[model samples]
Target: MQVSREEILHIADLADLNIEEEKIDKYLLNLQDILNFANIVNKQDVSNLEITIGSNEAKNVFRKDEVKVFENTESLLENAPKKEQNMFKIPKVIN
Candidate 1:
């Protein structure tokens, strides 16, 4: 699966990329290396390998949820630059 320079230029054109003249060879080599790797992987035999979804036996594992109350209020807001009504305040983000 040899990639030509013209095909690389065509791909750049389709992607709307401004590839410099000197960088064309670099792009061509990188693309060719990727295609070569893909071809190598495609030629491998994986018929004996088992199809497994996960490495662990656990499925949908979740911890118990509980509310925790902090006794320190002044210490929590001590480092905040802008604190309002016992909370960190920020400028309106959604326009």
Candidate 2:
């Protein structure tokens, strides 16, 4: 899992990153650590693991929709800046 300076520069170029000269060593160490961790993960055995397409406890919690007229219609229209025919009047948007 040894990452070279050339590989680091290539990765930086691919990611469009401008790594400072002093920070190149830091990037090289971090990239090598990531590669080492990936190698460790690739060595794991998961052949008997079940393939889950969906959750076991998943269920719809939606309530049934109901429509009812408001009791205080005049009070709702009182806060509107412009009212016309008991509806809020807004500026015309389309020409």
Best by lDDT: 1
Worst 10 residues of 2 by lDDT: 51-60
Per-model C-alpha lDDT, please?
Answer: 0.89, 0.87
TM-score for each model? 0.44, 0.44
Candidate 1 residue runs with Cα over 4 Å from true position: 44-95
| Model 2: colliding residue pairs | none
- Superpose all Cα atoms of candidate 1 onto the true structure and report the RMSD in Å to 1 decimal: 8.5
lDDT, candidate 1, 1-95, per-residue tens? 99999999898999999799999999999999999888976687978987679888747978889888888888989889998988998999999
lDDT (10s digit) by residue, model 2, range 6-93: 8888888999998899999998888888888889756878778876667776666897698877999899999999999999999998
Model 2 Cα shift for residue 35 (angstroms) = 2.1
